[model samples]
Target: MPMRLTKLLGIELPITQAPMAGVQGHALTVAVSNAGGLGSLPCAMLSADALRNELTAISRQ
Candidate 1:
């Protein structure tokens, strides 16, 4: 396949998993990243502390 945004993001594919807060699971991001797609996480709606925690979790994985 041709290069796409996913490749720009350092992934192997051009498909990204849509992130939905309170709906889609955070694990979805890791899964999509593993699959070469850009994994996304919805944290814009979270508070500063919550966002920090979420980022820490991501960093750990």
Candidate 2:
């Protein structure tokens, strides 16, 4: 059967990494995204500038 999550998220794998604030960043998110899984950026503990920078970094990958 087709995975609902994969179809909904447009990813090959139906895996989602939990957003771990203060423990993870864009690198981990990019890695998961590259591997065809849903990756989350933990924004709760980040400042606006930090979030923007992380977003920029993720986009660059």
Candidate 3:
């Protein structure tokens, strides 16, 4: 069978932690990516400059 979402993501389940900037961190983003499901982030709350920083940091990881 095709890999389920979690297996495809290298995680135990096909779930993601929210990308809550106030609470979530880079570790959470990479973790979800590594685990397979998409991670959530609140880009709307970020200013353009802040978004740039967040994107840059995630890209580096």
Which has the greatest TM-score? Answer: 2
lDDT, candidate 3, 1-61, per-residue tens: 2357656766565676765757665667876776766776667778888888877888898
Residue 61, model 1: Cα distance from true site in angstroms: 0.9
- Scored against the true structure, residue 7 in model 3 reaches a CA lDDT of 63
Error of 1 at 47 (Å): 0.9
Q: Which ten residues in a row have the lowest lDDT in candidate 3?
A: 1-10
Residue-level lDDT tens digits of model 1 in 18-51: 8899876557887788788888989878888887
Superposition error at 7 for model 1 (Å): 3.2
Q: What would you estimate as the lDDT of candidate 3?
A: 0.70
lDDT of 2 by residue, 6-40 (tens): 89889999888999999999999999999999999
What CA RMSD would candidate 3 show?
3.7
Candidates' C-alpha lDDT: 0.78, 0.94, 0.70
Q: Which residue segments of model 3 deviate by more than 4 Å?
A: 1-13
What shift in Å separates residue 15 of candidate 1 from its native position after superposition? 0.8
Off by over 4 Å in 1: none
State which candidate, 2 or 3, has the greater TM-score.
2
